[model samples]
Target chain A: MRSILNITDLSLEELDQLIATAEDMIADPKKYSEVCRGKKLATLFFEPSTRTRLSFEAAMLELGGSVLGFSEASSSSAAKGESVADTTRVVGCYADIIAMRHPKEGAPVVAARKAGVPVINAGDGGHNHPTQTLADLLTIWRNRHTFEGLTIGMCGDLKFGRTVHSLVGAMARYAGVKFVFISPEELKIPQYVITDELEPRNIPYKEVTTMEEVMPELDVLYMTRVQGERFFNEADYIRLRDTYILTPEKLTTAKEDLIIMHPLPRVNEISVKVDDDPRACYFQQVLNGKFMRAALIMKLLEVNV
Target chain B: MIIGQIKDGIVLDHITAGRGMDIYKILELDKLDCTVALIERAVSPKMGRKDIIKIDQAMDIDFDVLGYIDPGITVNTIRDGEVVERRQMALPERVVGVLKCKNPRCITSVEQELTQEFKLTDRKNQVYRCIYCDHKASK
Candidate 1:
């Protein structure tokens, strides 16, 4: 009867339950693999996202459930003028659970209103991507083995990065979490997020132009890429872009136990040279995403597989 | 300028003055064959200048249509030339079909037959965005 529209929709209790389930799945994958054997997950991605789409499909498939629905918007009935409400209603008939990723802000809200089954917002523009937040939560929990009293540095493209927003919202719920926002002036984290989520909650945070200054003090370094097209001033973009590139030299400044994560499809943001570090957890984050998603699919559908 | 009122009909008041014409055209008050009188720039302290729409027939207006008319207007029901029920009709929490989404690339904006829906996110900002395209319809 409920939908995963935003991170706030999941209460602290529900989030704890989801995180616990994800940890259980991660601990023993085979034991939970067949919990959704008879079910189906309909992924209606209005915006084409190969990684997120594949993650949802992989989660469902590994759970022994089948995947259906369109990866691209044009491939679906949405191309021929079908509203999200109508599409969800129609797709809900064929699938047990629905996951939608739209370029629009509230497309999933429309889907949730009319969907006969549970709806999950895979990603909806720069507005929200709650499931990714779930993955990040599980990853941070598993890597650090705790959620509190960490200097979390969110570096690069914080302005329009929905992942950063979701993460900030999620982490703000935890105790003694300080945030260091590292980004170029133009790509500084949106004020709405800072004022609305951080300042009001009295979560201590500071803005920094360089990662090295805060990198040494950080326990978690979450990196994001700066797409060339996102910036109107090409010169500023080029200048600051190189500064955020994580090389092996950067790790010398970071704590040995520091966990680095990127919501992948990264382009030169974190050099491949840094991937060898034991603290690099982006790949592990990907696997954790699958486990978290599998946990979500099973829980939402009330299936064991 | 004495403009008459309608009995047992809806009177939309405090319309930020000149927007009454836009609402007349948007609601297509002419086609309804309802006796409609539009007054612009009538002085008032609340709206400074106000526009009032007196509809002869009692018909439930789409809240989206009401908001599209003017973000500031309050829809009031009239009976026997007296105010019976008056409430500011909000651009509902969720809008089905009223205004065209401005984004050319959005699926809803491109589809000619689609019923455009916009979930009003920033109520205080008076921001009503397209659910299909994330486009804001600004006046």
Candidate 2:
């Protein structure tokens, strides 16, 4: 069965196709409403994520499919110590497709291995989050209309930012894409990302401590929050949480059409004042997430309007 | 120093000087019932210094552990005190139940029954990542 455990699972063509489908969905929502009429989506979230869980549930609902499964581990059989493999196997018997989010990395991979139906990894610890990358991709595509020759400056915690990692991995596949990593020394992008993704592809990228230095050069400024949950040391999280804040002052040198994005659930990493700016596409990213997810669900289910 | 030739077993040669003990410990050579000899810092013409291991019984060996620890090491199968076949090691694409994922956030840490697996992601760098968490394996 096909499962999206990582963003790399989808090729560049598939990404463009998904983007095209999402755009078409936006233009004609009623045309695809009943595509997944009899399908059932099981959202197996072992972690608490209101946004991602609801997004999947809403996507299934909007596609005329019913949604089942629990919101958190506590509400599921996982709390009673049932394995993800067994749970997925049981849920596969009920749901046509599965969207799983777990606190442990590779839990969805285990589920995908055991599950007979298609599996979608919503979020897997600090590891892969393919769907979030899909949302970011669609948002970037809609705004810029191209991934080529775009300089993306990713700021804040890149070390544990799974979304940033996934996006970088996805974007590196495109030609003429450059990355400017803006983060504190402690939370810089991992070496594997540099070695495995950038260096191998000969993709041009630079790491900088200050975002202001690279602000004017970026066509896309992807801001990520320094999540406290990802940090083992509370003091370290506190120190780096406010390291890079995107304010209106920071945008003075940025391009007028520069698209600013966040994965949402922001905590002071992006100021509220910047939300009114025409370039702030984070909220639109959320709405695009639903559409992209709907397109993904349809593609995985092999449903046609 | 000279070690006796095994009538039937295997000979491990050309291990990097200091990593013999690591290979020995990881392979649990001490648990073997048959006679085993570890020659560390042995004189070698090819290598400035090397380590060699001799086993007295023909038994199943975990080649993944051997390949992971020292891919350059040579393995010679012995029969009737004669070298029958020689093998050169390469990093296996995937190894299972050999190394554990140390990352606490890995699903294998909680799911004890799950097999601990690692994939050789970077051959140039000799980097193996835990298949579950993508955490780089530290040698």
Candidate 3:
């Protein structure tokens, strides 16, 4: 059974295939609508994530598949202190596939091992969120037409942003892609990502503090929220939250075709004024998220149009 | 340092000095009923000084633990007071339940029944990342 626990789990070929499938779904939604007819999807969200849960549910619904399962741990068997593995095994019998979101990192990994059916990791704490990266990739593909040679600038909380890490790792596989990490010193990209992902692969990248310094050079400016939940200290979160707010003024130096992306439910990082900017694609990223998820669901389910 | 020879047991030789205690503690050899010897800072011509652990009874040894704690330690199987077989330790590709992931958000932290597993990602640096959260195992 195929399970997507991390973005790295999908090879470049598989990623391309999923992207192609998403594009096809976009081209003719009615053709692929009932491909998963009579199938069931169990959404075992051990935490509260309305957007992700809705995205998964909508994807299944669009695929003509029925959706089952809980939204939070309090509603699920997890509240009774049942293990993820146990719940997954039980749910596998009821649903053809599972999309799980948990507050604890690698909780879906446990579920995947026990699940007889394919398990999709929606989000796992501040860890791998492969589908978000899928959405980001689709957005990039739609905007830039290729992953090669794009100077991508990632700003805000690079350290704790799993989407940034996953996206960086995914994009590193493509040829000639450059990364510009723009974040405060405290929220700088993790060292392991530099040493392990970028350095080893000879992917050229630079770390900078100011967004304006690298604004004009980027083909993609990936903005991320400084998540308050990720920070242990509320004061630290408060101090760093407003570090890199992307305003329309900031994008004056940016490329006219520059794609502004964010794994959504964003708070104030990208100003409301920037939403009117033709370059802003964060909302488009949300719609792309649904399509990519539908593609991912079909792939993991081994369904055909 | 005079230590009694084992009749039928396993001998761990050439452990990097100062890590014998770590090996002992991690292996939980102190709980063993049989005679277990941990010789520290013993003179070695090749290594300047080394640690050796000798177990007086044949038991299932975790070679992965031995390899991870200190690689290149020689394992000698003593049968009737004679070394019957000798094996050399090397870095294991994967280790389970040997190291605990320190990442608080990791699934292993909340799920006590789950095995703590790590895979060797960088061989030259000897870096093992948690299989669950990809957190680097603390040395």
Candidate 4:
């Protein structure tokens, strides 16, 4: 009935229900395809994100529902001088459920307020991206069977990584989960994340400049690329270009069972040689994303689990 | 050692020395055409060393921006050689218009028509973040 503004909006009880429902969908896919046969999903992506937009579409299609809307703002009326409220008011007429992605931080919050139906935040500007965090949780649960008692090494650009921030916030809610942040000083995790979430929760963590030192101890290695265009000086980007590269040589020291995940469209951060290895679960993570979305769509649409 | 008697004006004391230019830029003091006395290196017990700006005819001063930039400032509202309202600088709740967000792709910055709004979160450190963009305030 309300908007999916942030991951915190979903209570722990609801999270459990979603997890159970997703697990049910995973076990039996065909049993609930026609559950929401006539509903509609409208994806309003103001930015370019082929993977997430595709996953949302696939999720809707798998439920025997339909998908409508634009992957970019140019194709939509937003290229005009229309406000977010006006756009959502228009989109609300056609959509049964709205999933919006915007470059502005609170654009979805504004959209959700105007939307006639449920609004899911696909991504927001350097802010919370709840659904991706959902997929991440689902992926972790599916593989490891639990969220706690693990050291997750989030390497690369932690300062600008929205997914990493959301994941850190979500994991702090669990028990016995420690974090090993591997990033150069220029791209270290923001101070607010440590002060507001990790330290306050009494969650133990270590900040390291290199990945190789902590690679063996990590249960999961979540990689995100350093955004070069954000740097005011090109030299700063050059200085920390290869602070973390998931090459096979580095993995020789890592545990055989250590799972690797990336919010994809990866650059040279992940070497191609690691793709052939079974532990490289980024593509599998993508598949898992679709399943997670399918399960999410069904539950959100009031389809039977 | 500079001295001026205030008949009807506000004397903003305890500002950071050499930060008067930034404050002037932020408030657009010259455009407003108010009589001002810009003082630097004023000595006070609280600030040991400070600066002050006296606006002769400014009806409304944004104490919020003053506090946000530097909490050490003291504001004195005077009328007829009598101090009307005087207090230390306090954090502003809602800053109506301020600097643009650091994010170039942000809706506020790109949209052009929308005025930027920022909430003052950290008062002591003067951390102001845009409400819509979540971009850090750029000095």
Candidate 5:
């Protein structure tokens, strides 16, 4: 069975089709509500998640499917020393599909290997969150109309942000896509991403310390939270956390059509005042997540709607 | 000075100098009942000085593990004191259960049954990343 363990697992054609399907779901929600009727979705969230977990649960509910499984590891068989493979194997027996979120990277990959049903990596520790990429893609597709010839600016902690990593890997596949990586020297996008994904693909990209330097050129500004927990030194985190805060002043320098995005649960990185701006699409991104997830679940389960 | 020739076994030749012990330890050569000789700092025309491992027993060897550890290694099969087969080794496209992924958050670390698998992502840079977590294997 096919599993979306990484964003790159989906070809550009499949991504386009998924995005199109998501748009269709948004256009006519009532028609697709019963697409996944009688299907069982197992949401195995081994990590605490508000938006991602709820989005998966909401997607299944909206699709007329039943949702089962845990919101955290402590409540599941995992707390009793059950392995991910065993848990997925057992859950697969009951559920038609599985959406897993884990603190450990590759936990969903392990689940996918043993699972009888299709496994979706909801979020894994600083590794990958392919569905989030799909949501981001859908959001971008709705706003920008196309992925090509766009300057996507990724700000804040690029190094540890799995969303940024997955998004970059996804967007790089499109033609004429340029990246502006804005981060502190310590938190710059990993070299492997440049070497493995961009360089070989010949995607033009520039690295800058300040967001202001690249704001005007960006078509899409992807913002990520710089958590104190990700830093070795508390002082460094404190110093960098405020470095790229997207204030009203910063938004003025950006393009009028620039799409401001954040993988939310925001902590001061994006000012709440910026939420009122017409360009801020993070909230819409959350809704798009539900639709895209519905599309993903339908596609994975082979439900034609 | 030439070492004792093996009658029928396998010979790991042209290992980078000082890496024989690492390869030996990794392969657990000492546990084998047959004679296993590690010749460290052996003279090499191409490499100047290299290591060689001569196992005096025919057994299936993990070439991927050998290739991962040292890509420049040459494996030779000895049949009746004659070198019947000689093959040069290169890094394996994928390695399983050989090198442990150091990433604490990798699934292999938490799930004991999961094999520590890595794929050679960058051959020019000699970069191997864990297949599950994509954590680069440290040299």
Candidate 6:
């Protein structure tokens, strides 16, 4: 069975198809409303998540499917020391598909190996989050209509932001996609990402400390929160928390056609006033997330038409 | 000078000097009932100095571990005190249950039952990343 453990799980053709399907879903939501009827989705979240968990639940619910499973580890068999493989094996018997978010990296991979049903990694501890990338792709497609020759600026906490990593990996596959990585020295994008993903592929990229210098040239400005939860040292987190806040003044230098994005539940990385700007596409990105997820469920379930 | 000769066994030769003890511990040579000899800092024209291990029993050895520790190792099989098969070692594509992934968030770190696995992603750089978390295995 096919499962999305990472963004690379979907090929370029598949990604294009998914994006097209998402656009279709947005155009006629009622047509695909009952596509997943009589199906079941199990959300096995072993970590605290608001947007991702709710996004999955909402996507499944809107598709005429039932949703089950816990939102945290304490409420599940995991609290009793049950393994991810064991938990997924049991959940597989009950659900048609599984969306799992765990604190442990590659927990979904463990589940995917054991579970009879298809497993979608919701977010596996600072690892891949393919669905969010799908949403991001759809948002980018809706705005720019193409991935070619686009300057994508990713700002703040590139090291710990799994979204940035996944997005970089996905976008690097496209033609003429340039990246401007803006982050503090301590939070620069991982070296393997540069060496394995970019350097070998010969993708052009520039790493900088400030976002404002490259803001005007970008087609998409992805703002990520500098999360304290991901930091081991509290003092380091406090020092870098406000390193790249996207204020109204900064947006003035950005292109008029620039699309500002954030994987919401954002904490001060993006100023609240930026929400009113015509370029702010994050809310639209959230809606696209639902659409993309619905399309993804259809694709994974092999629901025809 | 010949330290010892094995009738029917395996010989690990050309191990980088000072790494013989590491290989000994890794291969658990101490647990073997058969005779095992470790020659450390042996003079070598090519390597300047090298380590060699002669096992008196032909047993299953982990070539991947040998490859990971030092790809320069050469293996020789002895049959009736005659060197029959000679093998050169290179880095394995994937290693299982050898080096533990150091990433705290890696699933292998938490899942005690899971065997730590790493894939040699970059052969040129000798970079091995945890198969589960993509955390680079520090040499």
Isolated chain B TM-score per model: 0.84, 0.92, 0.92, 0.84, 0.94, 0.94
Give lDDT per model, in order.
0.82, 0.93, 0.93, 0.81, 0.91, 0.91
Clashing pairs in 4: none
DockQ computed for model 2 against the true two-chain complex using alpha carbons: 0.83
lDDT for each residue of candidate 2 in A1-305, tens digit (9 for 90 to 100): 59889999998888989999999999999888888999999999999999999999988898899999999899999989899999999999999999999999999989999989999999999899999999999999999889999999999999999999999999999999999999999999999899989999999999999988999999999999899999889999988889899999989999989999999889998999999999999999999999999999999998876
Query: Regarding TM-score, does 2 or 6 come out ahead?
Result: 2
Per-prediction tally of clashes: 4, 0, 0, 0, 0, 0
Q: Is the docking of candidate 5 incorrect, acceptable, medium or high quality?
A: high
Report the poorest 10 consecutive residues by lDDT, candidate 5 chain A: A227-236
lDDT score of residue B27 within candidate 5 = 87
- By lDDT, the better pick of 1 and 3 is 3
Scored by DockQ, the top model is 3
lDDT of candidate 6 vs native? 0.91
lDDT tens digits, residues B29-95, model 3? 9999999999999999999999999999998889998898788799999999999999999999999
> All candidates' TM-scores?
0.78, 0.97, 0.96, 0.78, 0.95, 0.96
Tens-place lDDT per residue, model 4, B28-99, is 777766577777777778767777788887378777778777777788888888898888987777676766
**Candidate 6 collision pairs:** none
Q: lDDT per residue, candidate 1, B1-139, as tens digits?
A: 7877677898888887778888888778888876888878889887678988888889878777677556678888988888889888655677676667775545554345667777775676666766644557655
Q: Tell me which of candidates 1 and 6 scores higher on DockQ.
A: 6
RMSD to the hidden true structure, all candidates? 4.3, 1.4, 1.6, 4.4, 1.8, 1.6
TM-score of chain A of 4: 0.95
Worst 10 residues of 1 chain B by lDDT: B103-112
Classify candidate 6 by CAPRI docking class: medium
Q: Candidate 6 residues A118-164, lDDT tens each?
A: 99999888888889988899999999899998999999989989999
Worst 10 residues of 5 chain B by lDDT: B105-114
DockQ ranking from best to worst?
Answer: 3, 2, 5, 6, 4, 1
Give interface RMSD (Å), model 2: 0.7
